[model samples]
Target chain A: MLLLGKNTQKSVLIAGLAACLLAAPAQAEEIWVSNEKDDTISVIDVATMEVIRTLPTGERPRGIVFSHDYSVLYICASDSDTVQVMDPVSGEILHDLPSGEDPEQFVLHPDNRHLYIANEDDAITTVVDVVTRTVVAQIDVGIEPEGMAVSPDGKYVITTSETTNMAHWIDTQTQELVANTLVDSRPRHAEFTKNGTQLWVSAEIGGTLSVFDVETKAKEVTLEFAVKGVHPDRVQPVGFEFTEDEKTAFVALGPANHVAVVNADTYEVEEYILVGRRVWHMAFNADKSLLFTTNGVSGDVTVIDVASRKAIKTIKVGRFPWGAALRP
Target chain B: MFLRTVLALCLSASAATADVSVVIHYLRQDIEQPPVLSNLDPIPEDLGLRGAELALKENTTTGRFLGQTYTMEVTHVPPGGDLPAAARSALALTDLIVLDAPAEALLAVADLPEAANALIFNASAPDDSLRGADCRANLLHSLPSNAMRTDALAQFLVQRRWDDLALIAGTHPDDIAFADALHGSLTKFGLRLRSEKTWAFDADMRRTASQEVPLFTQDLRDHDILLIADEIHDFGRYIAYNTWDPRPVAGSEGLVPVTWSHVVEQWGAAQLQSRFDKLADRPMRSRDYAAWAAVRSIGEAVTRTGSGDTAALRTFLLGPDFELAGFKGRPMSYRNWNGQLRQPIPLVTDRALVAQAPLEGFLHQTSELDTLGQDRPESACTAF
Candidate 1:
């Protein structure tokens, strides 16, 4: 280390301050959301409930998923028929992956090696190898296959058929049909219980949540709520997330414009938070302390305190927000 | 004996051919009866029938080419009356039927065998489900879909940068659907709802009236707009002047989204409005515009095909270039994909219709009119 003059010391001090600012721990995890109508992704700092950055994506991006280790994010451009891979840190498009016709939603495998794309118009789920960005397999489901999810064990994949009112289970290993369960009309999103024993299917038209036993493929319970027609005939429960302890699950009721907070153990609705009109999808912070829901109709993302189940603040996002994911 | 036999054959043929007539059967309750019609201030009854008259006139003008004439046999069925039998009897002689009935009555008519060949034009009942899940192949809607109207208002609000909305809805069957359409539009165009308040329909009219008396107050300052969905035309009017906060009202009443307006003079609307006023002796309203579109669509079908055959007319009406030079900007035609008519609706303020969209700037990647209602991307009607 050489001794420096006053000007040099000033420059060093400035560099040190810049380093400190860069090194300081980020206070909150960011939830990345793709707005279908606006063609932009809103990066929301979970702690402050503020939009830190809005990353532009391809036309009409609907589905979104974070890469393993949360380095990259993939969004399904329904209009563009391509999966947009973006670096979440820089909010830049890293690469584009070809997908099936009219991709609406995506589900990532536990190993993070494969991605399942729900091709809405084609009514098929196309499995794409993440690293290769190649379509590996395509399995037919039903008319307008919308929401998709991967099982905890990464052994199975499930998709909701909007018009067919059914949930399809596919064996991820063989890329074959596992089971077909007839659900309520316009079944939208499917979410597995934290323990991975049960699955909850939200029916947009039927306005009821169907709980099915995954292993035995048996119908368990249909969770009914007080609000009728609050969600359009399309209960369109688009996005769902569970608390860290797996004690609670929050379901975003699409056209119903409300969030159903379900107690995981009791399987009862702990509370219904009226967030905004046409609430589509939701995301949870890394710590699972807060839940963020995108209200498509209201063009705002509502932040809910997980413990209190109360809406803390609503940050205005782009038009018609469909999907959201968190940056670890 | 041969002459007598030929005479008998001629008589039998004459008996088989009934007089060509089109029956207009509607539910008595659904139709604004004399009392309700009398109560309609600021809107005229003949204005309500302007579309019907224009359609009939167009038919009469072009009927000479087809060697057949058209006539409207207006029949009002009392509430809960048997409409199917009445419609069947009418369908035997009538080539077309225009219905302004409730959803149940429309469904009942649709279920009839005679209604198969006879085209049914729904003038009211803007419920979107009738176009979506409960869509009837035989039925074609002339009235703008609920989504269309809501989208009109939403587009207008969006262009004005009125992003925040406070929605107030009345407790009515149509009101709920209207609200849903409004909500759909708001979401589609990226508008935020600040607060939503529900008012009871059966609640004291006086109280409700006073509740909306101060319509625009400071409390409403947070909202850029107030959307009121009162199809009953009761509460929404009050909301205009009496909101506890001050905000412009949009929806059923104040700033209404309609297919045609008396104030709409642009794009040959003035000529149509004048023609309608001359023919119907009343100022044009939305219902009149829809009714006119229904008649005009049928007339255009007949004119283009130059045949009274229902199948030929239906095919022509469903085809592109079957345009109606109605009051709306540009000629209107059905989407063919869903039988939804694509027309520009007027977003009217109290003084005058403020904006119209598919406005000049708002262009659809497809047909510009496609931007007016549900885009093809999210449309549930897959069967074109």
Candidate 2:
């Protein structure tokens, strides 16, 4: 049955991490943004905050993530129906993995050997063996699976289905759906706390952020946005981030042009930091000192200082910048 | 490691499957004569049913991955047929029903005790009363009501500063209903009805009397636009360029407010149009879009909840947790007060789309789409 109890899979991940001690400290230290319309990935130097090189790739490059050791980068080239692997240093194509169909987003396993990819159109979550570059398992999920998050403990992998309006919880060990927790409409992203106690999902059209208890999978609270001059319809909650300390969060309010800083424990929306138009996904730099947001319509990335919660810079990017990820 | 992987594969393979059955019940009102139109083709035999079938296949594409499969059973009843009996038979089979019938027949089917536990989608009937005083707890409408369509046009006219309207209505039941809706919109938007007239001509315009059609529309008072209410397609299309005062014609003629149109090419609508065109071998109509939306609503619910239980689905659908992407550049959801779907109405000409209503200035507390129809404050429906 679905909604099974949480399995004890953390020990397995901890043991795996113990073996890869050398790869932990030598971080990649780079920022990559996928320009959806450009079908290319732009790498930025973490120290300089400047574009190093633009690597051409598949049809629609929406999601990008670096492998745990930072030797390889996996790009979910959605329109091409494959996830392309590339060497970060030389920017050379390593291989292409059959990632179901329309791979919009993916989460690399903590074990550093398997990758969980969300196929947007086909409603399937394919788990691929990174070493073999072959699909290990394909789990059925809801329609338009866009956002994926692996728990800190690595026991559960949750994929937020946009059309289905639910965050499907998949047991990592069994590769079967354990629970379908209904959220608001058009959930674009999901992020778990560093401690893995709570999961936050952004519902873009529903104009709310839902917080859920990780173990029980019960909705704890729903937060709504109210910008002073903006209409409620424009206050679409999209991608969000939870600080490493799990005390604060920054949620990108698309079309509203604001990022809401929320109190993680109290679930209080503290302030709305203004940003660019149609602000989408966000990423934190190496030290969590700077937060970068890809503004789709405005074609720029707004950089926010984490300490002051103020936007400091707006860097121009390619057309329709969608998602961003940082390696350190 | 190999043993654990093998065991995991076995466990996932034995996972439970979620199967949902959706039944479409339509009352085919038999008529002795169909409309005689020279320019446009006659209405198809399988108008709404074909759309539901296409959506079933679309749903199955995604459903197969979730271990969910959708099956549609269509029951067609003849004129003066036992619609209630047919609805009862279908209700016994599935709790998810799509009704492609008239207002009265839909109400009869909804009033059944067995349908209390069902989640019904109204695919065809566009009567305002269905979303107003006669709304049911089980019935969810995908089709936009007459009030919504008229309000959409009125909003556009107000935005364009076309304050004066010359209203002409035919002597048909549906025409009268549309006329009433137009009058309501005029009052809602503070527009002036410069002149109102009724046409009683029954002569065939395809024959020698075609010249008289234009002559009949002449001599109207000062008006910026001519709004025709001819649901029977008798004179709406003919009055476009033949209007007496050289005014633009709308409301079922030159520039119409519709639920869906083949001309809509924005917000990924081309993908749906192309997919539907490949399936139906013709351009998709408003009725087809309505039916497709109805089935997709159910498919969305089942995919989210992972259960076909009617009570859970109904609760989730009526609650804030429901919204379906209808290829309108926005997410469409149901209004809790009345089960009408709150969506943007596209104003389209024959060749290209003009604009979507609930236009920029139209404001609402909850959603802008509420401005296009009977909002929660003005809704008289409390059935649910």
Candidate 3:
């Protein structure tokens, strides 16, 4: 396996050059960014910090998630209504998984057997069996289901319905809706803590992050964003990622162009790290040394040094860069 | 495992049993409406009601998961019927009401003391006065007002550099009101009104054998576009191809400003249009879209607030946190000043979307959507 070593000093050097040039012997680990309008994925080599290649994909590719084994990648081609499986190494189409209509975003089950897809138009969560490449279940959710997350133990699959303004929970075993906790408006993304005790869902328009107790399915805390100079309407929280230690959480504030770093235990926004316009999604390197964010309107990905909490580089990509996934 | 199954079943059953009902108090005056010019398409019989029905189904689909039941009771009353009685009946049934009546009927229902606590959504009436001095505390407007529509058109015309306008208004009172709004918009945008004329065609004259249209529209001078304000749909549709100057037509027809149009296919609107078409067996009109927005707003409030209590729902709606995703590019919320829905107005031609209003560079301190209609400072709504 190719690994991008967490060399802090080397990354600091690469940050100054705007682009990294790697030796020929070093194996390249690539990060894929899905460009929604371009209908392609820009592969950036971690060793070189450059867009090595662009691979064509289905129409309006928005969300991307990798399998546990890292051999296959699933792309949510929203306009095509199919979760496409591609070989991560070769960037070749492997199979077309049967997703519900207008699948916007999805999450892979930890068990490596199933995939939970949020169909934005059909108001349902489509469960696909990975091995069989067939749809196993279709669970009814709220209108415009756009976000999906599975619990740490793979017991519950949470779908955040944007229009319905609720986080709907479904049992993984029975494929039945278990409970629904109302959040704020336009909930775009949901994430479970590493310990599985808390679930954080981001409301894009409501400008707040709602944290819920996993056991009771009740909201425990709500975090609102307020920057010193940023207006209230611009601070839309869309995507979120937790640190490996679970001590810090990074939220992608869409249109505000800032990623808010929140102290996980205290639920306080510690700092706002400015990125690009209309930031959509985020991913971390294998060693958790660096984080990358896809900025839709700016057509670039902002790479942030995890330890320093500073953006290192902004690499230009295709139009409307949406979801990002790192393979090491 | 058996115990867990039993518990899950019990939980599901209990969740499924709870019910919440919403009634669309569709009070329409039962009278023969005057026919428009033959060029325009005939209005649908279930114009506003069908959209509310589709929205009810959509709400119920999500409501089922949340263990809530939503129902719409559409009551049509005759002309000069007991509208207050109809409002009382609907209030007894459901606190949430969607109004599709005229200005007077809307005011009559809103003026009722029994409806003081009830939530009313206006889906049809587009009078600017409703959002001005006559604005009510309990009523929220879903449809765009005449000022908003005209301002939307004005912004688009400014963007296109169509400065000089020839105004032609209809004979109806509603037409005159719309024309007045157009005049306000032209002045606000600093555009030149080259000439103004009122088409004095009565309902019978609209169908006359005489060539009055050509005679009236002939010999217009120094105008970039002909702006018609035939809100009754009487003469606006015919003015497009019949104009002697061969200039473009806009306003009530041609390049019209609308809240929603079938041609709008951006920002995931195609999905909504298809969903509505499948349900209504026709393309969604602006009125239908307005009615749908009203019903969906209530659903969103109930879902977000997680309460069936009307007072709690109203608080959440009037609160700063309320927002609804109506398939537009951004989330829509209510303007607290006048209870008008703050949304981007789409300007469309007959077959394609031209552009959305509150155009680029029209800045506002709070939101760009505020530039399209009455801003907070100029608003006369003192009642909240």
Candidate 4:
């Protein structure tokens, strides 16, 4: 009778959590732009499409991410080699955490206690304690490790090596290399499925997106871009977000100046929305109604309607703007 | 046990006796005769020898399993020496020879009776005729042809959208040939020659100082690029700083096309440059890369084929399967049609090396690298 009661209580708790998640807002409503050359972050009021405020940060701030609670902002200062923690509401830097040399991009751990930084020139990933602002460990990676993403379960971290033409997986707990799988020439960025079953890698030189099975570590499919002579150097599949129903993945192609809408189930490119030159990172609204992309070379931000997959407006920004986050 | 030991001893003795040895006749020509260009640096006597040393190092590290060894016999021929006799002496010693001789001397050596079976490589000349109408079946060109270098420059200019060019030529015969090659490339790439001017060489200074004449008072302002052809190096540097217009310059001087540059630090260049500098006590020039690539090619051939036999090495080198790491980005191979070593060329400026052709974006239908030089469709020579 006591064992039966315990099982009933566990099921009730899971059901309550599921109900809460379903009732939560479906999208992020406001957009935050990290302007690298301007050394400021532009807060866009999504409804009115106006610049709410421009907050100043460190020199050459490039990569950015918001906390899971949407309270703190993390910005990677590439030239400074530090991740600046900021209070998003007050537009103030709360603290600074030392990262590896030339930290280009980073991802948050599932537990929200650790951050993994892809230190570009140092060829290593630096793990930092979020609350303490201390570096816990350094994981040696390949040459020019750039874009990174943590698995959904937070059990592994995947990083792309630009020159070495391989993607490496590291154990989250031990920070040891678990696998070094060759994907394509000049693999740039990686993304994992929502269920953590498969990982998709973009090859800059080979001009193809390679999909690998998470367990077997074998390539399952390759999605080739239609553009020729494009010199896919930076297939930056950055700022990935699912649709309202979690059926589609919106991928931003930096140099190709297009956004690829991919079918989440079939692993096929559904549509490509053209944007400004060197379109980089992207963000979405709270209701999943609008998507904002930072165009690096064109010095603008493209606002796209998620349903139409068409750019509705472009707002001018600072030079070489990259990274975008959203706040409700 | 005693019988087994005796059998082992006999096997070791036979293996030692079966070792193969081959000799390479390195024929070095001293073309520094009277009437030599005064401003140019004298060709170093050990240029080819330095290349041979690097090649030998690579071979010993990777080619020892082939059961063959390489040794060179250098015969330095002064100006007006008996070419046939020198070649015959080299042929008697070794079946393979690397020749650094002038056009006339090359022709004379090619006419030798013993030159038919012996393999000869031209390591110095840039003349395209040696691979064209005057092509010899026995000769292989390790140095790039004049057409190849000009094509490299022309492709770079086209990529940069500099289509209008001002042609500056010198009166020397070699300069004329260089100009012809550049003109052919410009025309082939659809670039317009806005004007052509002659920069007559001055005997007193051994330089082309004709820039003071102001030949481009009207036409110079119209051109998008300045193309200079001064083989003696006297006037090219002056042309760069004193071009009529502020437009970018390309050709022999400004944004020059070269096989290699000391300033190149991309890919595997840093290690090769350091190795060459440590050995030669000076920075490596374009000539050094060509010479180094030639010897390295031989090493690769032997290593890949697992044999140092001259005929076998030659066959493997000429085959499509052979590829050598020439410090360039891609594997270097030979153009089967003309026996030209086809490799990526570097485009350099005075303060910085700007770009490389077969630049990142340019693409060919078959191979992206084919855009850098004469494509197979335009190649005249039929022999592979």
Residue-by-residue lDDT tens digits, candidate 1, B19-38: 23333433222344322212
lDDT of 3 at A166: 73
Answer with 2 or 3, whichever has the higher lDDT.
3
Error of 2 at B21 (Å): 8.7
lDDT top scorer: 3
Ranking by TM-score: 3, 2, 4, 1
Better of 2 and 4 by DockQ: 2
Docking quality category of candidate 2 according to DockQ thresholds: incorrect
DockQ for candidate 3? 0.20
User: lDDT per residue, candidate 4, B1-384, as tens digits?
Assistant: 101000011111111122456566667667553342344656565765666565555444322323446666678877767767889888877767777777767767866888876667777778887777676766777777778789888888888788877888877777898899998888888888888887765563442454453443235638887788877665666555565466666787778888878889654365566667767877777766776677667755654455657778777777876666565655566666667777777889866778777776666775555665567777666645
User: What interface RMSD does candidate 2 have?
Assistant: 7.8
Q: What's the candidate order when arranged by decreasing DockQ?
A: 3, 2, 4, 1
Interface RMSD of every predicted model, in angstroms: 27.6, 7.8, 7.1, 19.3
lDDT of 3 by residue, B1-384 (tens): 011121122122212344555454555544457777574477787888878888888788767666677877788887768878888988887778898888888999998888998889999988999999999999999998989999999998898899998999888888999899999999999998988888877574655523566667686668999998888887676677677777888888788989999999855587788778978899999889999998888877776655778788777887777787776666688998889998889989989888887777677787788887787898999979
DockQ scores of all models, one per candidate: 0.01, 0.12, 0.20, 0.03
lDDT of 1: 0.70
Worst 10 residues of 1 chain B by lDDT: B1-10
- B166 in model 3: Cα distance from truth in Å? 3.8
- Which of the numbered candidates is closest to the native, going by highest DockQ? 3
Q: In model 3, what lDDT does residue B191 have?
A: 92
lDDT for residue A52 in candidate 1, whole number 0-100: 87
Error of 1 at B266 (Å): 29
